[model samples]
Target: MKTMEQIRHLYSRAGFGLRFEDMRLVEQLSVKHSIDFLFRSSVQSKPLVSVKENVNYKDFLKDDQLSRKMFMMQQRQQEKDLNIEWLKNMSTGNTQLRDKMTLFWHNHFACRTLNAWYAQQLNNIQRDNALGNFRTLLLEVSKTPAMLQFLNNQQNRKGHPNENFAREVMELFTIGRGNYTEQDVKESARAFTGWGFNKDGVFAERKFLHDDGQKTFLGNTGNFTGEDIIDMLLAKKQTAHFICTKLYKYLVNEVPDAANVNAMADVFYNHKYEIKPLLEFVFNAKWFYNEKNTGNLIKSPVEFIVAMNRQFYIDYQNPDIQIQFQRALGQVLFYPPNVAGWPGGKNWIDSSSLMYRLSIPATVLNDGVIDFTGKTDPDDEAFIATARKEKKAVHTRVQTQPDWNKFLSDIPAHTTKKEIAQLVLSPAINSKLLSIINKATDIKTMVIELVSTPEYQLS
Candidate 1:
């Protein structure tokens, strides 16, 4: 049986699994001390944004047509450059846990950055509210400049309401659909009237455009504003249950057992929607350390990358290569596939992706390269020529000097391939794959094989 501390470390490192060092320390401390340390230390990662630089809402609309177009173009360029810098920060950030949790919130309240400026704002909001209160996080995200623009809440008005934000708030964020009615959505939409981004892409509530009229939402009638609507929605028991159930799937296992979920809901609801309290409850619970929960989840691409980075203390000096590396392996920074975010676990593996994931570590470590040239046709001369050119580019331009010594030093010397495989992969391993690994002459080959396997996708 895994120690409670080891379980925490596994959960943190693997699927936000705990760091082994943290686990060791926690074992000597009280649960209260351990829980406090996790949260307190988890937020050590400095945000990409700083304390100054006020975002003036009026700045958004100052540019005239020619200037506005020019500004927008400039913003795109800035974002491209900024993304590389942010990647560097994420790679070397002090607070790995906070960055990881911020990513978790990003997927939960999904937003796509169409432009650079809005995208940067979206990223900052995620970092700001990552370890904070759930209510505050929800409110900030709702009123955020990027979110308002993304969800079409900027178009919400008293007379002509846009229901996009309201619909998502129910379906994706708060109640997860079926819990709210069409009438409820319609009413909630009205409450959010005049919630929009200003000229500077900062949140601004337009009073003249807002609907102050009495509205009925979820059987409650009043002169409700957007905040009031949020309050009411959160007050619902179903909201607590929804959030708790999702947390179970994320932190424990993909599937939620009824008894576990209900127990979480009871604690979450009783605490007036405090996330930290509920997390403590879950972490302290016996089921979280159950053998079934161990190594059950497949690490998301980000999780996999972060865990590897953490384990090896690896840092790439080139931001572009690091950023491009993730893009090649899938899970590009700041770019989620859709509002639902990356479909994690088994969904991360397919023929195309699995090969890349398997090859990426060696590629990064050994300075290997992959040709993206015309590998399309079996017998096309033009494609063959393109493939040759691309291969040349890969060999020459994407140059890297892999350090095997560092990689070897990172893992235990006496650790068998099977033990390392269990550390990296999940519960089950294929016998055929195991046989292939057994044939690997050395640790490096064995490491590559384990990572290359279908099982490595799991935590």
Candidate 2:
């Protein structure tokens, strides 16, 4: 692969896509230097805090007369603001890989919560430990208030053990399904009983409620605790393989390359699940830049929004439009479809969503009309508000200001349409598509036209 192609592919998979500011610097270096640059630059990540004022979560718990309707309204608004803020964060800055990886882990360890404080804490945790260590990330995610409440681990207790938490910890989070048996789930559930959060949202064990009985799990017999079960899961090589394969699908291609994934698995296992090294290995590999793997994967809804914003150097006039786009495209932030998370790949391109996905660039850039007639997420207050506001209107405008001049300044004067297409798209367009793209009068027009096409839907 050429250096530029490799760089674009790496950035697309590693981060979002190459930023205009990084263009000059990246052009001077090879793929290896770019890999080092990306890893080195992401050593520190900025935290996302939508709620500036801290509120005591326990205060709400203590209030006996707190109105349920008022609480739901507050919770929904807080989460909506948070969702938009994170999308805005993802759109700008040098924190592409860090923020992008956080998005990956967000879906990987899916948890839903009404408490915005707990949600913010969990997101920052993912960002902080995104490229650090899988062991640390897994442990922290497993213990978070969001996860505990989402999986009903807070209800787990002796003689009334909730198997929901234990089953997911094994089947979804750590090792994939089939690595353990039903008996393992039952035993592990007993071990995890009494694992609940305190009033302050801290992990606390209800000692009296815990079943401190000796149990056999995954062929090991002992008086195991929840922490012990986690340790045992990490010890299994299959855990590494499961995570690696999933990563391979996300970063490389939807269809995993078994040989390359096995190599990645070895690195992840031997390095004790060090995320940075495993990703470095993948980015450094020649097979990762192969033509077959270049642009086959469809862009997830979040990725599409981020890439568009970055490419245009866009600033949304109404940031709430982000949640609209997300809801329309079938991947709202902070809201996974279920415990298993959003089923990515082709699932992102259903008949309803694909039309909106293709029309997004035009809607955001050209002030074109955008309709949210596809589906409505009743859980999101912002979405419902948007729907109600525009219910009678035929053409609702997407409020965004794209700085095309600033972005166009970054493009070299000598660059060809073909090269520009390669930078914006994954797979090369056909002759007919090229003829269509050639109709644009200027570079900005060409780009706006390109992004509006079906080919631009893939990253």
Candidate 3:
């Protein structure tokens, strides 16, 4: 049987872990209640972010090089601000499963924002659909203006259809590679030709641009629509296995045994692709909290920082410093390095990035001050408050330094430095980390040193 503490650790590393109070709540609840809460709490649509809308999408294509570059830069800064604000709510908000599901879906249908406004919009959409029906998410993603533009679906039309979105939908999103053929992609491309967005960023099916000809997809011949193509793809058992394998790697262990994966796929497929059912079955499963899985994985940069901030009640008005640190730490806002998104876990640690991760807390809680240019104001406290208040607001700045002593005051005094190491370290305490924590005289130093460890990368 999994102990409560071990279960909490599993949940933490699997998602953002738990808040201190949440940990207490989970401790008190029956496993069924605890599991049910994960799904029930996530059933609502996330509140929309408040960003400056009515943007002219055409202005981005200005002929002047300087003007375009300036526009791109401003847009990038705005996206960073938006991301920082979202992070604050994600870390501190009342709803736990919503943020966790948002994180999961962001990786599921990963798209990067080249423009800040577009990225901010994309981020909000992902949050809105985080806990909705899987079919709804897939359909929403297909029509999302940001996705349509990012994957070049805007160029997909009657005569010359771009197959980028179609290829990804089959290969990356639904079924794994090689489950479908080149002919399937070509046919799917034809079906999705008219799936695009209007000027106001809403879905539009342009009949004039649509390929109305019959398409032979997966041995089925018909004048299939884009929705039909998706429906056909989901009917395959491979889609279930592909998604289950991903969930296993993320929520269970990185290296899932084949037997477990097959079982998960069976449950997922039988459940009609409702994500909550699969997850509840997994979290409630006896093997989910096994010793081999507990604290064995590493946290992604966003998860690492957000969990810590929430646990300590660490608030930042000016997320620029944190944002700069995030960039330095190899996971920048609005920009994913490529289409596949961040590899995450152990991949988040490298020689250059590791040093920056170790150094970030000091930067935020001590002497670090982020430089601001353009219209962004880090000194505006109201902006910071707005930014952190469950929705969109400009990021704020911190005039006072963080107090480490007060930060760990709530942790039991009876707790040893080793226990503190275990509480935060992702991969548990290896000798190097154990040595560092052992040498520390007090909880504050031990906390910092443990975070600075190689093991800390796992949290």
Among the numbered candidates, top lDDT falls to 2
Candidate closer to the true structure by TM-score (higher is better), 2 or 3: 2
Most TM-score-accurate candidate:
2
RMSD for each of the candidates: 5.6, 2.5, 6.6
| Candidate 3 structure quality by residue, lDDT tens digits, 263-307 | 888887888887776777787777877778777666677777777
Kindly give the stretch of ten consecutive residues in candidate 3 with the minimal lDDT sum. Answer: 370-379
TM-scores of the candidates in the order shown: 0.81, 0.94, 0.86
lDDT tens digits, residue span 1-459, model 2: 779878988899988887556778899899999999998888888888886653554556645554644666677788889998899888876877888799989999988887888888899999999999998998888888889999999999999989999999999888999999999999999999988888778888889889999999999999999999998999999999898888888998899888998899999999999999999999998899988888888999999999989888888777887888888898989989899999899999988788888888988888767877635557754646855865442346787899877877887889887778778887777885698668867777787778888888886
Steric overlap count per candidate? 13, 0, 8
TM-score of 3: 0.86
Q: Rank all candidate structures by their TM-score, best first, as comma-separated numbers.
A: 2, 3, 1
How close to the true structure is residue 420 of candidate 1, measured as C-alpha lDDT?
Answer: 56
CA RMSD (A), model 1 = 5.6
Predicted candidate 1 versus true structure: per-residue lDDT over 386-436, tens digit per residue: 557553323323454445565566554576776555555555557966786
Model 3 alpha-carbon drift over 4 Å, by segment: 60-70, 362-406, 412-417, 429-439
Cα miss at 252, model 2 (Å)? 0.6
